[model samples]
Target: MNLTQKAMLGVSAVAMATALAGCGQTTTYPRTAPPTDSQCRDWEWDSKNGVYRCDDSSSSYYRNYYYGNSYYSSRSALQKSSSYSAYKSSITSKTSSGFGKGSSIGGG
Candidate 1:
């Protein structure tokens, strides 16, 4: 290829790399489990205080903050949590639950 074509190819490659780099970043958040303690051996979340229980060590310094890897310790905990129950009730309580229902406009 000629000089101009080579330059264009290089520019395209850089642009594609930059876009991919931006898209590759994953969300992160503080560990759901509590910090380590003198007697703790495993992460034991203390949902009530928004902290991990002092008796357990955290799994990691940070966790992937995404839908599939939720901070919850287990499925049972997630299902039993008030937020889960509330969300579940909201969807099942209504005949037209979940997206597709046009939003309502209000003037009050």
Candidate 2:
């Protein structure tokens, strides 16, 4: 190719590389969704605190709780309360008992 054509190709390649690199390094935030009934069923529940106890077998910081049925990782009282409220709200909304015609006492 001629000099001008070669130079244009080089610039275009660099621009494309930079754009791809930026996309590769983009940060992603962790997303939490309301837990499903099936997920919660197997979970050991802490009635007093209303937190599900699950084994964090994959986490080095949480491996200690994995034995003999996992317990909810301990959290500050405020955090636990907030989590409990969010869990309750999600369940209430999804279950027929909350606002639908189904009996309020039964599970969704």
Candidate 3:
């Protein structure tokens, strides 16, 4: 082909390459911890007379406090807390990654 035609093709190829390269970028998010108190505390305690009982109007206490039941309760609470924490952490990380103006893939 002619030199002028070859140069135009080279320029067009470079532009296309650059445009396609943009589609393969790595998406990232900032590391963040989840919400501790607010998320975990919202779980409703089992109020049935069989396993758990409310000691008083205060929501924390439960009755029929046996060893196995206590263990189960603690484990359940921890699992719920951790799940909520993880969810919150992910959301925070995504938000930070999206809005972090200074953060970029390559160091400028």
Candidate 4:
């Protein structure tokens, strides 16, 4: 084969190799089962006061929920008491019951 053709083939092979390497790549979150300790984190989340919980995407993906809202984790302070559970229940009850058939904005 000519040098020019050989160089082109080399470039094409390198490109194909890189492309194939990326095909099997998968993103994985390392959270598994509920944390045993009062304070632990496995995935990205949001926290306020002493309350910690998974964000929107993580909530649906991991099924980490308390009441109706997604709660992946909580700080030691919240875990030390029952108040957090009560708070979660209140928030979930209110939000979940807010839905109605006409809630959807669009109509056919």
Candidate 5:
């Protein structure tokens, strides 16, 4: 094309390249380790069978694996835990790339 048009195309190509060059970064922090033994006390209480029914020596940390099922060490810890996922994740995302917008190609 003409000189001006050529320069514009070059500039546009540069701009587009710069824009698309942005990194597609992805990071994932795997679920943290389960509560440790030092974080335990005794065990939790069960309404029907009472506490320490799983293992008498089982600490609070181990008791959670049984009837009590207290995942976290303490109340505040449960609230503060980042990996304490209560429900299944039902979320989703979509990424769309195109010349500009989604439109019919080579049409009237």
Candidate 6:
């Protein structure tokens, strides 16, 4: 190829690579310990009704578990957090990695 044509091809290749680098990227908010709350309750037997219940504690447990181990498309994406502490902690603990990006995480 001619010198001019080769230079153009190199530049185009670099531009293409840069454009696709962030594609398919995902940010991981790994599973972390649930926040401690004294209000949370445990299951209790209702002998009169013959059914076990504890103010929907079971529902909250599963919700927290699943929400804690969630992922986002990018670091800037919005997320639903259980509490301010969890949100703040995740800010520093989250990790992001993807194809075409360097191994150094959070490098941007």
lDDT of 2 by residue, 1-108 (tens): 999999999987776555444432322222343234332333343443444444344444331211123333454542445454575566544532322222332312
User: Model 3 over residues 1-108: C-alpha lDDT tens digits?
Assistant: 999999999997776655555444343333323223321322233422112223333334432122222322353453345443474466545634321222343311
Per-residue lDDT over 56-98 for candidate 1, one digit per residue giving the tens place of the 0 to 100 score: 3353423211122344544566566676566545543452322
TM-score of 4: 0.27
- Candidate 3: clashing pairs of residues: 53-63
Residue 86 of model 1, lDDT score: 67
Kindly state the number of residue pairs that clash in model 1.
0
- For all predictions, the C-alpha RMSD in Å is 13.6, 18.4, 15.4, 17.2, 14.7, 13.4
Q: What TM-score would you give candidate 1 relative to the actual structure?
A: 0.27
| Model 2, backbone clash pairs (residues 3+ apart or across chains), number | 0
Global lDDT of each model? 0.42, 0.41, 0.39, 0.41, 0.37, 0.41
Error of 5 at 77 (Å): 19
Candidate 5 structure, TM-score to reference: 0.23
Model 5 regions more than 4 Å off: 25-108
After TM-score superposition, the amount by which residue 35's alpha carbon in candidate 1 deviates from its true location, in angstroms, is 1.8
Local error of candidate 4 at 25, Å?
1.1
Residue-level lDDT of model 5, residues 1-108, one tens digit each, is: 999999999998775654454333122223323333354554444333222222335444454432224454344454354443321111101112333222123211
* TM-score of candidate 6 against the unseen true structure: 0.27
Whichever of 3 and 6 has more lDDT, that candidate is 6
Residue 90 lDDT in model 1?
A: 55
